[model samples]
Target: MNEGNTALTWHVDLSDQKLPRLLLRLAIPSVIGLSINALQQALNAIFVGSLGAQAIAAVSMTMPIIILLGAIGEGIGVGTASFISRHLGAGDEAEASRGASTALALAAPAGLIMTVALLAILRWVFIALGASPTILPIAIDYATILLPGSTLMLLTIVSGFIVRAEGSTRFSMWTMLIAFILNAALDPIFIFLLGLGVRGAALATMLSQIAAISFYTGYFIKRTGTVLVSISQVSLRVDLIRQLALIGAPATTTSILAALAGMFLYGATARFGDDFIAAVGIAVRILTIGALPITGFCIGSQAVLGFGWGARDFARVVKVAKLMVSITVSLSVVYSAAVVAFARPLVKLFSDSDNVTEIAVLSCIVFHLFFGFYGIQSFVTTMLQSLGRARLSAVVSFARQGYLFIPAVLLFPGISGFSGVLASQAVAELGAGMIALFVMLRQFAELRQGARDP
Candidate 1:
């Protein structure tokens, strides 16, 4: 079949195929792609760690800002994808194309705005996040290089969404894979070979993201018939923007809240010392390597759910949700166990300092013990997004990162000190998981009843 026919066939299969087969077909490439990206980040930390605790802490400090920017991009991407998939499910190719085009058109401006905003508030944000004086300058330097490249990062995510909306998971995966491979090759060369230190890591990352954006732009141009992005089709339609924000706002909040939680965690940890900051930073990056694949699966399955729900195929929605939740939770268990078992070795990869190693190892084990709960929450939120239940998704998403976590981090630390800080995450995860489970069951039950009645 030609590319256009292939894209249409994929949309048909999303609604027609068995849930297990469809989920795997869509989810696997995304999982691999996200996993490689996470690995590249870990490697970056490992390389940058050699410079000292200040460098590591600086990198850690910048994470929340980076995440907030990413939240915006991915939020738009997810909302755009949801809109497109729903249209495709209803066999409205023209509407789907319009969403694809509008999302692409918005990417650059959105990115540019984020760049300027982050740059203007760089110092204040870091200070509020509890960066030490020694780490502040280093953090500023890194952000300077990275903020301008926000345009590329945002567009890359938007492009991924467009491709995946057309059921081109492999194409999306390859875009990330190729970029990550290039990043992996460039990190050491920039950081050590050129002696650029922290700035080198930022430069390497920014360059890699630009490459990803170029690849995505080329893909769309080459496959124009499959994934259209025309200037004429772009519009500031109030309804379209509202629909995007309805889902995208809460989705973005989920990540922004997560970033806020991280900032809070960093501030709390900084009280102990800079080494602690560095240690927690290393542990979080390591944890990401495992957590991202589960998220990738959730993200990948969004298309499947959107198609089913838009087609009013409630049975398919339920089946896909069940399989995805089960698979992700199981994977989280295995991943958590492995990380805990090799915590010391993993920490060592990033640092040789005994103090940093001890803290990172303990943080690694404590933070991941409740991995199953985190995975459950992620699965439910993604399903909610797919069902276009943004409010409920927002509620569940808030619980994991902001609602429960903020209170737990504040109160628990006073009660138990350092251990309390570590345990607070597990507590939040458990609470959020229960709430997500309740909401998901309720939603799915209603969906099934509706299907039976009609």
Candidate 2:
């Protein structure tokens, strides 16, 4: 399976490849692409930071909302990808194509409805999310432009997942790279040269999304890809949608819960001050950037895992799981140590305010204390999702941010003040990592037994 040969080969026999070699081939491009995307996000904050801490805070406030809406597309994408990979593994290309078309069908209307619904209550939602009086107007300004254009963003996300489902990660990587490059180039021009401020940032992101989706559209239309999707092939049948929903709903819920958790964290931090909000926001971006490789690895492993599970290649699945978990854990430890050591310099990149820098450095250190454990939680969750174990996946996914982190954030602050707030996520990571490890061990045992039985 020469992955470099991208001339109209739609499906690759993922199970035929060596596990380590294949995983690296798929994951490297994704890591580079996602890392660049994360860097662009950090750069967006740096560009916006010139306006003031309040401006940075305003942008930070909108993240939860953006994530909440984006989760819809992500859900569709995950479900679609899972379906496509499994069908392809079973040597059913038609089913894979149907899954792709159905995903697009679902994403289009969902994006539109989300835009309309969110626009109606934009002000109130931000306010409830802990935007102060001064930050409220700025937050609204940013969200207004970003929210309405979310349809483009949604389309790009789903399309990227669809491309990757067929083991075309290079295409997925190119789309993301194009978007990141375009967004990075456009950010300063729009934010400063065009004098659009935060709204300009929003515009730049939308334009980049337009570029990404355009590539995807061309890929599908020309039938130059693994899955051939056309207008005539699109289906809205009840069973098909339900099949997608069953796998997708849990993934969507996981993200939505994280978004809600962000809102809750914002509310808790708000009482401390806008500086706290700004600091926390910066730390969040830093964490996101740091975790990109781990995310990329998990995402890259998905196609392989899905195909193995679908084909009942239990031994292959087990091998992939062990290798993935070990590599991700090692990467996380290295990144976390580096971040903790260089927290000050990284925080200073986004803000010059001594107060903001000080708070942000602290936040980064505490948030990443148990960060290595996150690799465990993330890989297991991805494995479960790839295996279509939605119920268990959701439980593991929710633990890090939802049930565990929420209570820790709410109660810890009262117990130990601001430091407690920073520690909440670390505690949650440790607990969730344990949960994931327990599940992984049991899952591997079951797979081993299955392999012997048949």
Candidate 3:
């Protein structure tokens, strides 16, 4: 590697570092990164929220699916980062570069295929997701802009993770910061001032993503010593595909499950009224704002655990896992409190209807009941993935987003009403958190025992 490449590293050797200090170093930057990205999306909702419930609902209706979009991209990113980080930890620099190359080579085409497929399924999917005719056009506009942009978006995600794997997260942080600022600055002009409404909002967001992808791509050019694998090297290398799919597919699939869960929830809420579905949509965005810290902690754990495992430090893995749990729990409490204290106003910030406000208030409270579990679930799933236990992560993901969530949304709402639907996610989140806690505890015990035995 070139001297410049080595100098760019944060050199986070998890085994040699103290957990609290290391986690803070990683989590603070990651949290900021997560916040900026989340803020970009939130700006869309915030702007639409001012347009009225129909406008908000039009956007909210697509949020779940949009998350699915991100998940596919993120799955690829995670797969690449995990492999690269391990190779780097073992001091195999050439292998690391090759892995990074494979990731980029694989992601672009995969993204193209995903986009084409999304295009074919767009109309039917929206209709199936309980989007009314009025909302269908809006969904198409937003989704279409996202289609061609998927490759860029996916590239940015994978590139960011790769750029930071050796530990200098500044570029990742900077890219997101710029993207969010651009997104924020443009939201008002394109969405409000331009008289474009929802389409404008979607376009503005896509442009911001273009900026992110450009910045990320530039880093690999003559700077990282070698670019993230050559596009020409793209192939169905079984080992490379296997490693990426093993870790990436579950996370990606779980995001799909969340989308499915939303459909189920929306169908159930439809029984109450269109306004109710709109209310839940706003409630979710509000909830996501508080989950940022939870996500940050989980990202840190993945990095910490992955780096620790790379160095073959079983004790360090355990320490990092514990650190994730502790940080996740503490942040969960703080976030939950803030959400509860300002639930009404927070909802109001995105929306302006009295009926929507009332429903948002009740649902927001129900959301808060399970809010404290968010970070715990993230910690469990991410740590397992970091340890290369993809199947465990998959099962845990299924339990939380699919099995538990779908049932609760369906059965509960059938027996009661919209109230039951609101309560369902809480039950699922709480159940997932408990299961994650148990599984992680067992893993920690295993790691500690290995340390003692050796």
Maximum-lDDT candidate: 2
Q: How close is candidate 3 to the true structure, as a TM-score?
A: 0.94
Pairs with backbone N, CA or C atoms under 3 Å apart (clashes), candidate 2? 10-226
Positional deviation of residue 43's Cα in model 2 after best superposition, in angstroms: 0.9
lDDT of 3 at 443: 83
Q: Which tens-of-lDDT digit does each residue in 205-226 have in candidate 3?
A: 8898899988866667645533
lDDT of 1 by residue, 1-454 (tens): 4766644544325664767777777888889889988988888898889999999999988998889898888888888888888888888878777888888787788878888988999999999988889999999999898888988898888888877876778777887988898898889899999988889999999999989989877776656335467777786898988887788878889889988999999988888889999998988898788889998899789888898888998877887888888899898889999998999998999999999999999999998888777678889888888778889889998997899999999888888888888888888878898998898789878888977877
Clashes of each: 0, 1, 1
State the number of backbone clashes in model 1.
Answer: 0
* lDDT of every predicted structure (CA atoms): 0.85, 0.87, 0.76
Q: Runs in model 2 with CA error above 4 Å?
A: 1-12
For every model shown, what is its TM-score relative to the native structure? Answer: 0.96, 0.97, 0.94
Show pairs that collide, candidate 1.
Answer: none
Query: What are the per-residue Cα lDDT tens digits for candidate 2 across 1-454?
Result: 3432443454345766688988887778778878878988898999998889999999998999988988999899888888888888888888888889988987999999999999999999988988899899999999998887899888888998888878878878888888888999999899999999999998998888888999988878766677878777788788888878888888898889889889988888998989999999999999999787788888888889899988988888999999999999998999999999999999999999999999999999988888998888889988988898999998888899889999999999888888888888889988998998899899999989977887
Report the Cα lDDT for residue 170, model 2. 80
In order of lDDT, best first, we have: 2, 1, 3
Best-performing candidate as measured by TM-score: 2
